[model samples]
Target: MSLPDALAASILSDRQLRPEFEAICDCGGRLAGTPSERRALGLVARLGEAATGQPAMRIPTPYEGWSAQEAALHLLGDDEEVELACYPLLRSVPTPPRGIEAEVVAVGRGTEAEFAALAPELAGRIALVRHEYMFAAGHLHRRLKYEWAKRAGAVGFLIAGPLPTRAVAGSSGRGHEDGIPALGISPEAAARLARTATGHARARIRIATEERPETTETILFDVPGGGPEIVVLSAHIDGHDPAESAIDNASGVAVMLAVARALAPHAGQFRRSLRVAIFSAEEWALTGSRIYLDTLPADERGRMALNVNLDSVAGSPNLTALCSGFPRVAELVEAATREAGIPVGTFLPLMANSDHANFAAHGIPALRLVAGFDDPASHCRHVLTAADTRDKVAETELRAAAIAAAAVTWRALTSTDSLR
Candidate 1:
């Protein structure tokens, strides 16, 4: 058998894939700067060393940290007040003890034109927007909606979750800077706050949070090849506090681990070194990878040939490489998948939604492998909701992702042409 086929077979047969994924899920939602994140990082350190035969290096990363103590939302009416379920978006600035009461305006889907049309009505009011399926094409990010609300002079922001009963969760994209209060609510809560005949509906939002300086670490494993050029294989270890963050990223980390195990032994035969970067705090605006890359010298960054980032790789049977505006990288991925007898799709846009964007901004060709792209029915919709658990990922799906990842990494490691 050919060497790539032999490596793919080894990865498919490796018994640690599912176990490692479940173990990460078992560690609870690995919220950055939390105990849960620490536990998962420790587990990954051991497993990564075992897989790559290299001790994991913990690169210290410091950043502003935030934790929500309490967040409450209530609808105000003439005679009765109704309380609604809500979760605070990460890094949301806390309101006063009594909270801010303001008129609530619903902007449909939070499109730019919608916000523009409602510009006059948004000022001094709380803007409400809908959260769409994230893995689909043309979908808007919550951070963009939040930023629109803030720029429109809105007092606060509310994102109605896509799920029926569960409240969504994600970063507010605001660091330690001044920002409006933000929260995620269920669809039912959004329905109740519709425009009434009398005037815009009024709601009260109270959020209490604490902020401090914190430090975390990004793990790295370097498996040197025969050449100076490097191929970076990366995945984020951090996720939301809701559920297990399974379909969003545990699948990616697991697939990465399995591929590393199967391919590290053959690095000496390849043309590029394989650098495994497992990052934390990715949920907080991709901070982990950004910090790691920013700290490197320009000469060191120039040595990087490509970055193949695995994220949300197995929520569905389908996989697509978000090639970060590099069409040649997409072609390479397609060829690798074809060689392995697996079908993988490609998208030719630069998505700042994952760690790969950090590498792309540095002029390195970077791509993010994701599952269920444009497939709303896929379990990836459950990400950031309470329903995102280990059960949402299937063993076969994870193995398929690992096989494809191994093939791609192997091809990238041995290819003589410039990846960029």
Candidate 2:
């Protein structure tokens, strides 16, 4: 089925898109459990209600809450000691009061083979790895690198951000487990830690964090249709504290709001209801969505027809759908995008990098719409750094993404074939 031109036009002409996007960005990085995150959630709840003309249903979820107090790194040489800038990865274990002083081992890209080759030397040493462009096929996640370091008996882990002078930020993926200290450093720091003529370079890492029981909520706006089946459009509302997190997720949330606003008036024509889910703690290994799916009854979850997760959707003009191993779902997305005159490519591999993966894990057809996959030069490369602000996203790019999302969602809602 083709997308209704009126809905498409509404999505394109959404005056609220830019305002909502900027509002979310102004909330600062919506780090889970922070005041900023709470503010963003409150704003999103209002926006969602405005779009769907219904009050939001909030589902409370419990999770391990964590916040960093201080993180410092010092490169120690024979006669010189240099302090470099660094940020603690989320859930990174706090170092001892005096901190951990150890030799640094460079593992380059921190691939499996690279970690294997440096296995013997990693024990009691700090593994240094580089953060690659995250929106790529072969990118090795910082979490994997940290796990490799831990498995190798490393005392600490460091990931150098791709951008110079900017420290990276993300989850350590340790998730309430015992793990070594991990930090994201700038490129300059990585170079300073390179091996000297004498032997391996040594550095001191000190990190302080507080962990406690925390609760966050997922906001749901249901635009009811004629049937019980549902189609979900989700976007993460949380991100690291480094910057605005505009491109990584604020863009997604903005576009989701626009699509919902355009579709709510036409819900009577849809065969399935549309649920706009604003999730939190997504940066912590997709925690919010995982909890949402886990807590939902099996029968209710089975009623889900498809999940179109928008994440980092507009840093670049190029958009690709991470199809989560669903070939049929990919075909449907392609047809929908084509019919809408929007260019969206599909990659069939299942990437557990976003909230959509959790939906796919529950046997639902799911896909993540993202921008600038495999394009290093795109503004998407600035994600996870301090540069992920509203300036990085263009108004045109955000609107196009909204139109594409609306098209795909409309197609799924009106399709006669079984989504399953």
Candidate 3:
């Protein structure tokens, strides 16, 4: 089916996506529980209302919050000692004022097997590992590595970035007690601390942080159709602060807004209503979506036909739908994207990388629309680092993703069998 002319025009005239993206970046990186996140929330509400022609609904979501006040790494080798730049992973446990000094053990990729192989050597040591591309096949999540490190008796964890200059940033899964102190170091910094046969190098990691209970909202806007079922268009609003978090999520949100504006006018004739969920604290282990899903009544949960979750939708021109084992959703997405003249890849297995996993956990058919999957060359490689800025995403890339998303969302809204 060809794209509707009206929707096409709306998409063409859309200068809003770029500006909205820039606006989000200007909010200073929407780290959860920070003023930046609050500002981003207000922006989303304003933009969502303008796009959907209605007031946005605010659903309060609460969680224990953690923030880093200061973090640093000091290398102490036989002949040299120098301080290095470091970013503490979100929710990482703080070090004492003087910090802990331990021998460094390079753990390679920090996988379960890697940690196990080095288990004996890890005790009282700081385990260092390379940060793999998040979208690459067989990628081990950093959270699990943190868990593995803790279990291996490592006193601290260090993840070296793929890029050369800046340190990487990610969640530490250290929100609970018994979590280890974790920090992200740049490639250069990691190189300096590398262990040689001459001696086992020792280093000190110092981190200062504060903890509190915080509350934020999941922004939602409802666009009606005649059917009893709803199609959820979700994207997380919060992201890491080290970068613009542009590729990680700001792009997903812009695409959602574009789809909302283009779909809102003709929604009355469709088969399902559109429910836009802009979740917060997503970088904190998909917390916002988890809470939102848990509170839904059983009947309400049953009323959802599909979740078209857009996360990092345009770090590259190519897109992949992480289908989460929902074959029907995958087929529908492929058909719509092809019909819209957009190329997209489909990965069938379920992944818990984004907010979509929360919906899938409840037996709801969900698919994550992401820009990069197997392509290590994709802009996703730059995500979670200071290099993930707006320039990494081209306008054409965002447009193609927007068109494909609009097509798929349009079909889901109009189709009689959304997930069948």
Candidate 4:
């Protein structure tokens, strides 16, 4: 059956999505194991019950939890010292209680070859690199740069953001044992840390954090249909520790909740059941989704027809479905959106940047709907920073994404061809 126009219209009202979005935003950045993340789980469960007519099930998932208490970076010049604005990378190790001092070295973009060129004199020095535009192609991830610097024997790491005065935020993909003291610094800081006529300058970094095994909950709602097959509409509920995390994910969760409410009426008539998997700790390298998917048995995993992941879906008005190189998935989305009178774009290459990659890795067809695919100047540039707040997205843009998502999900579940 085709998606009813009435159902589409029902989701248009901002009354539901806006408050839900704000509530999630008010919960702070929702970093894993934080009070904010815990509050979000309860709020989402209430929203899920209102949408699905049944209480959402909380699935306990375990992961290593990391949180920062305080972090500071300063450039120690011969005569005058200046403090730099910065944010610590997730899971970074703390420096000595008093901090560590070392000579600073700039490795440009910190690519493999860049590190190789400076390999001769990198030991015991602090490596400085630049963060790239996340939504663009060929953009080097911050983790790769940290690994390269670690291999080159750097004692500490610093990454500069694209925007000046705003220190870029990202994960070092490091643990207390495997990582050096890593922090994200502003471009201005990078400039000051540059070598002067007096040669390389010294820097000091101090960090205080707590690390241990912790458990977070994954909220799940299963609306059963006649068949055994399932279509998973998924999104990550947690985001960076800074800002409202609006563009990075509050937008996605808001869209998912609205869509879930729209589809609940047609629960058993569709060709397949809809399973809502609202996950957490996505900013921590997709840990929540990975653990949940890994727990499914072979037979249950095979029952998963598709995973439609919504993440960072409203930083811009334009939306693109990253289909991970699956031509059939792209075709399905295009046809559905066209049928709905919405012109949504599609990118065929597979990107492991979000939770969808976990599903696709398990051999299930998965695609991530995102905004500002290659547009660098879009509001997505604010993601992972303090600027990813509620104002970055518009109600119209979110409604458009919901329409596109609903159209594609309806087509995927009701199509007779049996999605490849």
Candidate 5:
């Protein structure tokens, strides 16, 4: 079979793609700014170039270096042990504990007005906040709440999790240099603690960390000879600690590799160039993509036809297409999926929390293709945890997603008219 036909066949053959997924999963947690992430970048650069027969480059990015000297949390009474979940604000506090403990107060929903109302009462207290509706509109609200909580003189804050449906737990206060130590508690644990704090409970938290500002890079690979315009394919090659981020994004990288390989033979046939970007620090607020947008020349930026982003693609039963404001791109994506016999549908505007956000922010047309939002059992659970390993991904789903993505991307890249 030809390359495209072989790609289709291999994608349909479940066992054929397991090795690639396994390789990605084996890389362990590739959190942004970590050595593992750099290694993963190199791996993708090599694999992508080999697959596409095109040159690839590694671009540097700006990142603040951080190191945890000591981090611990425990309830004072009855020696109740509380789990230590990383908070974005904790990086700003002083090293270790300074013998500071305040009364534990429930901040209700921790909204802006709610926080303003309770600001006086929250002064000098450790706030135990609930994440009931925080993730509803993405982490923007949650991040604002954290800032509010910190500004209210709350020495520390604890967030209750298992966020809303289709929402994954994340921290946005990473860049805060003067923030409090925030931690996420399981729902059951948080409920128990909240109930026990009728009068006042004590939380002894300590975090010893170091912060340094530095520059990082985001690599963009361009395959010439297709066309004058370009179709951007993006994936972040970063992972967190402990777990090998096979599903969180390595799946996306693997799919990009597969697509690059499939497109190699027909590199000169398409009417547009293929720009594959391995973005950096996506986990740290889409930093790399934003920088990339800023550096793009005005004329070149306008020439971008469309951005096809692949984040989490393996392990879901149904595929979802998240379209920006443009209706034509959405229609074309739907048509392409239908042509490929792939089950796809429109998903709610979940906010471009990934690399696509930067492009969308600049009014560039973009789409986020994902699978498994409806699958209750399959979600981005081990995202930042040590459990996000390769074993969590399904080879079959990864291959299928890659194939569908290539088909859609190829069609979009070769269309007579520009998608932009």
Candidate 6:
């Protein structure tokens, strides 16, 4: 069967989808388990129902929640009051020292090797590590390094943010629940603290974080048909603080809504089932995907032909698709791009960090489609900050992405040939 160009065009031309993007921005920040996150989930379900005429159900998963109670830092003997901004680490130690002061020591980059080199001097001191390079890299390597510093006998951790070329924000992860107080400081504040410390300066950090084990829902909307295979389309419905998450994933959700609208009328036409999954807690270590994978029946797992994941697709000049495990799927994506007149590019190896990771881990073929980094000014900035508002998204880009995704899904569902 050939691809349906008209369906793709219809999906792309739909302007009603803009309200969904606005709703995302209006939510402010949809951190996992927060009210904003719950509202975003409801919005997604409403969109799905409106497009597909089906009720979507929420699937709950296990998670430990933590909120920073009191976060502060005291410079050993500085009489000058230093105003420092700090965020608590995820899953921080249950009990933290309130006013205990220990000597401060600089451990360079705070890498494993660096900590090993400073083991002798760091035994009883608070480890003040420069997080400048780490922040620029978007908290990628900071966690492991912090773990190493903890093992080296550092009483507490003080991460110095990188010099502000652009505004930077900090967030804690599950690792922070290990019972040690972890704090992030602005670069200027860190510099002042570094200058004031003499030979031995006492550094005191206090963190009161609450950890609660709660079960949260993960919603999956499936449209099953009598096809030999299945094409699964996915998008995560969660975001980080300060970011309204309009571009990061709300854009992806809008694309999913458009796809559902384009495919609903022709659901029975294809020889395979089309599944749309709006995942939860994607930003929190792909929690929803992990749980979904574990619960899938083995027999149903093999029926999955391809998993197409849409993430961050609403604002860019060029669109890129990351084909992680399925080379044959890449060929189909190329065909779709050609039909749509959109360019395609290959990405690095699969990180299995998104919702697609769960399906890929079960040996299911998958592809992650996204907008490239060379987008306009509005879309590029405010990645995880407050700048990821609705105004940053371009309606043209969103329409294009939806059309491209529909093209890819149609081809994948109908094509008999396999890329594996």
lDDT agreement with native, every candidate: 0.91, 0.93, 0.88, 0.87, 0.68, 0.70
Q: Tell me how candidate 2 scores on lDDT.
A: 0.93
lDDT of 5: 0.68
- Among these predictions, the greatest TM-score belongs to 2
Model number with the top lDDT = 2
Instruction: State the weakest 10-residue window (summed lDDT) of model 3.
Output: 1-10
Please rank every candidate by TM-score, starting with the best: 2, 1, 3, 4, 5, 6
Each candidate structure's count of clashing pairs: 0, 0, 0, 1, 18, 12
How would you encode candidate 5's per-residue C-alpha lDDT over 1-420 as one tens digit per residue? 112565576556534256666676666666665677766777777777776677877667776666556655566666465543433332345434553566677787677778888888888887777664321233344567778888898877777655322112445455755777766555554554563525676667666767778566677678874567888888877755546777778888888777766765676677788888888677666777888888889889888888889888775656777776667777777778777777567654646567776787777788877766555456454454445567667676787788778877888767756555
The candidate, 3 or 5, that scores higher on TM-score is 3
TM-score of 5: 0.86
* Clashing residue pairs found in predicted model 2: none
* Deviating ranges (above 4 Å) for candidate 3: 78-80, 418-420
Cα lDDT tens digits for candidate 4, 1-420: 455788778877647887888888888888789888888888888988888776788999999988899899999977987899999999999888999999999999889999999987789999999888887667788888999999999999999987758887878886445789999998899999999898897899999988889999889999887688899999998877768888879899989988888888877567888898899988888889999999978898898888899999998988889997778889888988877767678988788899999998998898999999898899988998888999999888888898889888887677545555
| Model 5, position 229: C-alpha lDDT score | 83
lDDT-based ranking: 2, 1, 3, 4, 6, 5
Q: Residues 285-307, candidate 6, lDDT per residue (tens digit)?
A: 67778778788888788888888
Q: Per-residue lDDT for 1-420 in model 2, tens only?
A: 788889888887778899999999999998999999999999999999999998999889899999999899999877988999899999999999889999999999999889999999999999999998888997788899899899999999999997889998888999767999999999999998999788899999999999999999999999888788899999999998999999989999999999999999998899899999999999999999999999999999999999999999998999999999999889988999999989799999998999999999999999999999988999999999999999999999999999899999999998756655
- What TM-score does candidate 3 reach? 0.97
Measured over all alpha carbons after superposition, the RMSD of each candidate to the real structure, in angstroms, is 1.2, 0.8, 1.3, 1.5, 3.8, 3.7
Query: Residue 42 of candidate 1: its Cα lDDT?
Result: 96
Supply candidate 6's per-residue lDDT for 71. Answer: 68
lDDT over C-alpha atoms for residue 239 of model 2: 92
TM-score of every prediction relative to native: 0.98, 0.99, 0.97, 0.96, 0.86, 0.84
lDDT of model 3, residue 96: 90
